[model samples]
Target: MKVGYEFSKESCEDPVMKGELLLLSSVMFLLYVVSGCPERCHCHSFSKSVDCSQQGLVEIPSDLPPQTLTLHLQDNEIHQLPAFAFRSVPQLITLNLSNNSLSTLDPGAFHGLQHLKVLNLTQNSLHSLENRLFHSLPQLRELDLSSNNISHLPTSLDKPWENLTVFAVQQNQLQQLDRTLLESMPSVRLLFLKNNLWKCNCHLLGLKLWMEKFIYKGGVTDGITCASPDTWRGKDLLKIPHELYQPCPSPPDQVPSPAPQPGSARGAAPSLPEDRSALAECELKAKPRPANLRYAIATFIVTAVVCGIVGLMMLVATIYGCAYAAVTAQGHGGPLAPTNQPGKTAGKELLDSPAA
Candidate 1:
């Protein structure tokens, strides 16, 4: 009987041990398949995606395969992109580097990335981007920079970027954007610009017209609300009354108007000094201004607003003080204004103090 009991217990333990062995073998096989990735990354050749998110990476992975199409490096500690960082991965199409510490980009950061299409740089510390950062990326389409310290856009954005369709710059420090920047991006259909400090004033008139055209063309914009000019603050820029931009000056078309010769009669309007000034101003307004100039102008406007408010307050105080003194003088039975009914000093005004 004892021998039979022992045999039954052994029989039950044998199957348990075999099951554990099978599980361990499967785990080893999975690790082998994932061996293609780096120490902290997970690479899947079948999916052509390499996931290295939240890996505490201070720099880009050195061993990423050239066959990788979708590379995820979000939630890393990478700061300041080096030039040609992606020179080896011409095949990469989608790259996710959001939630990093990138502040600046080298001019040639994306050199030779001809196949790169979608790039995510959201939630970084980027204040300004290099003008030529994406010079060689002919196939790039989408760019995301939703949460950053970007106060001004790169001047190069006024040209190139032909295939881009989605541009997300929501929740930045942008007070104004050059309409030419939007005009240059003729292919963009969806623009995210919510939660920005957009100053709606005469400076924003051009952008409003562009927005109207964009809306007509079935483009999408999200909550482009104004944050300045006390009257229009918190108002949706697109919904503002058109009369607010009264006497809207149209930009000078690229097709030049026929210039008048010295004796021409009908074409002399454009040659007038005022007309020339208007055209020049419109032309300058139509294009993107230098970043430094825009910032200087923005600063000047803010300073002027502050000074105006202070001056207005002072003027009100002075008027009130003078009125108060006049009323007090009348109550104290002091000199009143001389009657103008052919009395003394009627023609000469008040030559001296008048009797009460």
Candidate 2:
């Protein structure tokens, strides 16, 4: 009886010891995760967010929590971003890097952020972006690049942003936009493009046509106003008439073949066909001369003057005909015509009747 009582007591005590050990292990794990966060950043385990904004961080922290979903690194003094800067935090969803001094980004700066949705890079000094810079972020939705100094966008994208919804690029130095870039974002809904230096020339005609279709399909824009060519300045791009683009010269039918190099075999194929082909491609992509705008204006003015002259001549002819008809009618209706005819007839009859 005594041995059985001791065994039962030991079994109950064993379960309690196991529970204590498990609790201690969990506490130690939590401490480890907290300690893993960067010294200047605060990590919230429950929300999986990291806050490092306004910390004067000159560079991205190397030690970021693997489970981090949201990262706030705005208002920092970071100047450049290296390749794969966020590879450690692959699950990042929202990244705010606004108000930084970032002027350069490696092509792979956003690598490993497959699930990132929103990125804010406003108020930066970015003058250009590398091709395929955002290729790794396949799920990006909203991208804000307003208030930068970008003069142009990449002519071609390595991967299309099929899921991008909202894109803002206001207050830049962009003179024109490549229509293909907008076409790549098939799912885009809102586009903000105000306060840019838009040149409403032949190069921008394609974009104007695309905007019409986009707006017709329920997309929205703030309207791009021209800032150049004096005549088109202060006018909305969409309002410009299509006739303005008609004066642009048609593209050349083919690139002229380069002259043969001296001392080369006459019948032998060119040694640098690749270089020639590249030259031809560039020529095909070049924008039409800006002088075409002047031609269009001149044509419009001449047409207006001709039409005005024709209308003036018609008015003068109508007035002259009416004045001449009024004078003839007044002379015929006057009493002088009847009196002269009667006097002449009476005089002739008396002269004929007189016998002496």
**lDDT (0 to 1) per candidate:** 0.81, 0.85
lDDT of 2 at 230: 78
Clashing residue pair totals per candidate (backbone < 3 A): 0, 0
- Score every model by TM-score: 0.60, 0.65
Best lDDT goes to which candidate?
A: 2
Scored by lDDT, model 2 comes in at 0.85
For candidate 2, the per-residue lDDT at 173 reads 92
The CA-based lDDT of model 1 is what? 0.81
> Listing every candidate in turn, what is its Cα RMSD in Å to the true structure after a full C-alpha superposition?
20.0, 13.7
Could you tell me how far off, in angstroms, the CA of residue 92 lies in candidate 1 after the best superposition?
A: 0.5
Candidate 1 per-residue lDDT over residues 145-177, each given as its tens digit? 889989998644544477889989999999888
